[model samples]
Target: MSAHDQLLVVIDPVARRIDGESVRIAKDVLCAGAAAKICLPDGPEEFSRALTRRGGRRPVVVGDDHALLRAVAALYRGRELGDEPLSLVPVGSVASVELARSLGVPTGAVAAARTVLDGVARPLDLLADDSDGVVLGDLCIPAEAAAAASVLHPASVWDTCRSLVRTLVRPAPPAPAPRAHRLRVEADGVLLSDLDDPVEDVRVRAGDGAAEVTVTHPRHTGAEPLRTLAKVVTVSGPGFRYRADTLDVGPVRHRTWTLRPKGWALTLPPAGPPE
Candidate 1:
């Protein structure tokens, strides 16, 4: 079979969760255009297992942002993602997939699936933390990103992993009540914002081997967010949490993230506009 002839189609549970129509449409589009092997794993372990065994088949994910991110994270952990392009057909609530939309995946199930069958392969940057986690979209501080899996710190390992992946794949939780956090922000070791200045908000993304960082200052008057590019971004101060794509990141006093340039690849439509 040609490189794209046979496919490993991994469907995230969330897609078939509310109604099966979305997933069914995507599946029909893909199967009609290409020969594929579909795997509908029931849990994270099965999901991870399905991915590991994807020999030479290009993986086309049918789900939302979290499903895509989880697959990417799993691939990243295996260390075989070096130029292996991934295709996505986003399926879930609109808000749950803002990241996928921003990244240029077609929102319509048929559009996304057909694109996977015909789109050109492209590379994408990733923001990786000390923890074995990956972020595909912008991360914001002074935000409510409860560790997508953190709140699921349960009594058993099996329960923890299962519950964590489920919660992680769900829609973003509502923002918590407003509360100010005094945090120190540094880009490549240079202080950008200090504790004296209560952090209003901050955003970060990977680009050109460095992270493009933006920090906002609280104001009664209009003020633009501070922006810069650096290899490393460290946040420390009173405990804080950040929203990385669709999941929440921390409540710890310190966290550091680095840019991994073109560490992963994506499949997008030919002649598509930049994301």
Candidate 2:
């Protein structure tokens, strides 16, 4: 590798937040070590434009979990993720990026940024849904609705103001607390869990060309969960939502995710477990 390797470092707004000292540290280390171009976009649209305008430069995201997901999704939509290996620098809220940390990204800002410059590119899998969405980690059904509020943003200030006005005009009931949902889960068309019994949880993980599906329910006497491996897993139930990584997506009665092997590559520590 040459000292002239150039990286397009896209810093998310959350990483550039006023209290984000860790993000600042990561930026400094990245710039000092390599020929890096930092793009600080104010919002999602700007982020997309910056990424689109990055010609012949590798992209390195500097943000928390959601930011990383968004970057991957943007590239995946353009059908460019497979050709380019992406790098990540985890910053912002610690609890928010458990996926990044668990994936072996150094929690420390400097170490993660250094990884962008010196680490090896590791092939990874992805869960691509029929709706054109991609999930890099576990996806769970029947997640808390309040979690959705935190991840989704209003389209504009007018939308925010309208929401506030509606809230004032009609005092809404308390949001429904998280609860189990009845679902019929099938792994490769084989029934895994029936809707007759309440499903406490449903998790789908991407593996090397397959998906690890886990279904959990209340046990009368320690009944074990139902688990299986499949290339595609479908969940159908009276409209249900799911949480993929940190983002919430759903309300559809039926959804399926196909496992993609070697979907993309990530810069990771040269010697260690995959993060």
Candidate 3:
């Protein structure tokens, strides 16, 4: 058989715990269609080693979004993402495998396995951050919008003293009111919002050759959000956490993400005309 017909099936331990039946089904289908060497990795280290040791065989991940992300991240770090086309057999909770589904990978075990056996490799865009982070889908600032606006604030000396006094004297302290964040957002060197303007939300999505950015201001109730397409997006402000795909990252003061067009490839079912 050709190299393309040989697969290194990496089954994540989480997948085995979440849904063993689906994993079995996927394995059976892939093994029947192609020469598949199953690798039941116990943890992240084994998983990485399995992929690293795979020679001439296409890697097929059988797990959730985290599993898929891990595989892609490994290839990306090795600078082999473009050279290798990855396949997935998603076997986890709906929310856990949402990323794979969003990327056009079938959630069904049989369908996903069949796609791996006979499918087209499609080029996909991704966001690469300055901190060596990769975003396969979209990213949003203040991971939890409601909590972010209320919690992400720099406390002054007086504020800290007052809090301590309140904790010692008061039996119950009132919750802080939610407030807009003072962030500076820039898209491709074009300033979308400054620190003077309070922002309600910020989102960046990977597009064809650029990222689509949207910045919303709390003051502008009915006004449209500031939107633009840019190859680079930068957000600077007080230390804040953001959600990239399924991961919540950083209390970072500043972050920059660049769009890498067609940076990765995935094996997906053949495209059909829009219904």
Candidate 4:
């Protein structure tokens, strides 16, 4: 089979444990449509090995956002990300596959698998940090927002009742007001904010060919978020944590990210007609 017709489907362990049926369905669809080599990796080492030995076959991940991130990071570390377009069959909780949904990958098993076989490879932008870290989505300083957003739903009625009872028994304390960080923010080479002005939060989004930055101040509740766009962004402050994609990273004092225009590619279902 030609390279375009060959696929290396890497089924993540978490996906297998979470949804075996969807995994089976996705595998069936992909294998029926193309020459697919299934790789059920036992761990990270094996997972990286499968991608490394994929030869010319396109890589398809049957897992959640974390799995997709892993696949991309692997290719990126090997310096093959720009050339190897990835396809994903999102299989996990709704929250876990959010990144896949955001990227226009189909969430359903059959649809996503079929997409792997029939979709077009679209180039997408990404943020590369000074430490060689990659951000497939936006990054936020102070990971609290991301952490609070990822709370999983109660699995059972009893679990729900327990949560309700706990809430009533010891009503949660009020959330602390937003605090300001003394971070120095710079876009491209222009300074947007500095340590002198305490800022509430800073967010950087990887966009078309530039990073969209927003800085807000805690003191001005009604004030608009300070926004700008640039090819590069730098944030330096007293050690602080940040959320990149779905992962929490750093208590570092400083960091920089450069926007790489159309730096990576992913196979996605074709866009439908505009309404």
* Top-TM-score structure, candidate number: 4
Model number with the top lDDT: 3
lDDT of 1 by residue, 237-256 (tens): 87887888888766778888
lDDT by residue (tens digit), candidate 3, 94-126: 999888888889889998999999898998999
Candidate 4 lDDT for residue 41:
100
lDDT of each residue in 129-177, candidate 4, tens digit only: 8888889997999523322334676479888899789989996776656
Poorest lDDT segment (10 consecutive residues) of candidate 4: 142-151
Residue runs of model 4 more than 4 Å from their true location after superposition:
143-174, 220-222, 272-275
For residue 46, model 3's alpha carbon misses the true position, in angstroms, by: 1.7
- Candidate 2 lDDT, 1-275, residue by residue in tens: 45327889999997788337887888888888888899989999889778777888889998888888989888888888897788999886678878888777877788898888889888899999988799899898854443434466647989988978998999777765556678889889899887887777899999777889998875443669888899888899988989888888768899988888989898888986444
For candidate 3, the 10 contiguous residues with the lowest summed lDDT are: 143-152
Task: Select the stronger candidate by TM-score from 2 and 3.
Answer: 3
* Candidate 4, residue 104: lDDT: 88
How far is 146's C-alpha from truth in model 1 (Å)? 17
- After superposition of all CA atoms, the RMSD between model 2 and the true structure is 9.9
Better of 2 and 4 by lDDT: 4
Q: Order of candidates by lDDT, top first? A: 3, 4, 2, 1
Q: Candidate 3: misplaced stretches above 4 Å?
A: 143-178, 219-222, 272-275
The 0-to-1 C-alpha lDDT of every candidate, in the order given, reads 0.82, 0.83, 0.88, 0.87
